[model samples]
Target: MSDRICCPLCRCAEVLLSKAYPEQAEVLALLREHGPMTASEIRAKVDKSIGVTAINNRLERLRAFELVARTRYGNGWKYIAKPEVES
Candidate 1:
């Protein structure tokens, strides 16, 4: 089929390292600490210094790379670390 592969953690790292996005780094660290979390939850845990749109953008990138999975949690989205990458 195709030769392209997706990786969220790598994408996250690339983006973060490319521009030194502090928010991205903070989010990654939070994810590592708390395991999995929704965008709103992460924002809250991170002190809401960054806006929702930025958080959403980062989450989208993470999801695309398959680094995280998004699921419906009641009325909002819940993000969890992909089990395959836990190691």
Candidate 2:
């Protein structure tokens, strides 16, 4: 991977990434590399071994932070990264 760990939302520099959990950072990086995806897809995409429950939890947390947006997709939600616009 490219190692440029900027926030998928907010465009925060690597410094801001420290605020997120390691898993959350990984999730964001995955989304950035790919695109919008479901929690399941994220779990499958990440290189490290992560559980579905953990991936789902991180997705929910990111969405709650407005770093990512979720849309209803069948029974689950499809998550997308939203760039944070400065006010």
Candidate 3:
């Protein structure tokens, strides 16, 4: 397989895949399914095989990319998927 990574926004193959941050895709997929969730909720939805820290890191990256939005809910924050608009 090629090392090229597709941009989740434009779906273009311009994004250089990062091995250091490999869990991004999986996290995005999960968000697409069960987003608008808190970090703990996300941890619960994810496979028990993965580490909690890894999921948190992936969430941080996703938030930075604006693929997900973090909202303040009570004392904690909730993550929600930023829907892509079809033109």
By TM-score, who's the top model here?
2
Q: Could you say which candidate leads in lDDT?
A: 2
TM-score for each candidate, following the candidate numbering: 0.61, 0.72, 0.65
Candidate 1 residue runs with Cα over 4 Å from true position: 1-22, 84-87
Query: In angstroms, how far off is 20's CA in candidate 2?
Result: 4.4
The TM-score of candidate 2 is 0.72
* C-alpha positional error of residue 39 in candidate 1 after TM-score superposition, expressed in Å: 1.1
Using lDDT as the yardstick, the better of models 1 and 2 is 2
When sorted by lDDT, best at the front, the candidate numbers are 2, 1, 3
Clashing pairs in 3: none
Report the error of model 2 at residue 46, Å.
1.9
Residue-level lDDT for 81 in candidate 2 = 75
CA lDDT of every candidate: 0.66, 0.72, 0.66
Of models 1 and 2, which has the larger TM-score? 2
After TM-score superposition, what is the CA distance of residue 16 in candidate 3 from its true location, in Å? Answer: 6.3
How big is the positional error of residue 74 in model 2, measured in Å on the Cα after superposition?
1.3
Instruction: State residue 36's C-alpha deviation in candidate 1, in Å.
Output: 2.5
Clashing residue pairs in candidate 2 (N, C-alpha, C atoms within 3 angstroms): 10-84
Alpha-carbon lDDT of model 3 = 0.66
* Residues forming the 10-long window of minimal summed lDDT in candidate 3: 12-21
> What CA RMSD would candidate 3 show?
5.1
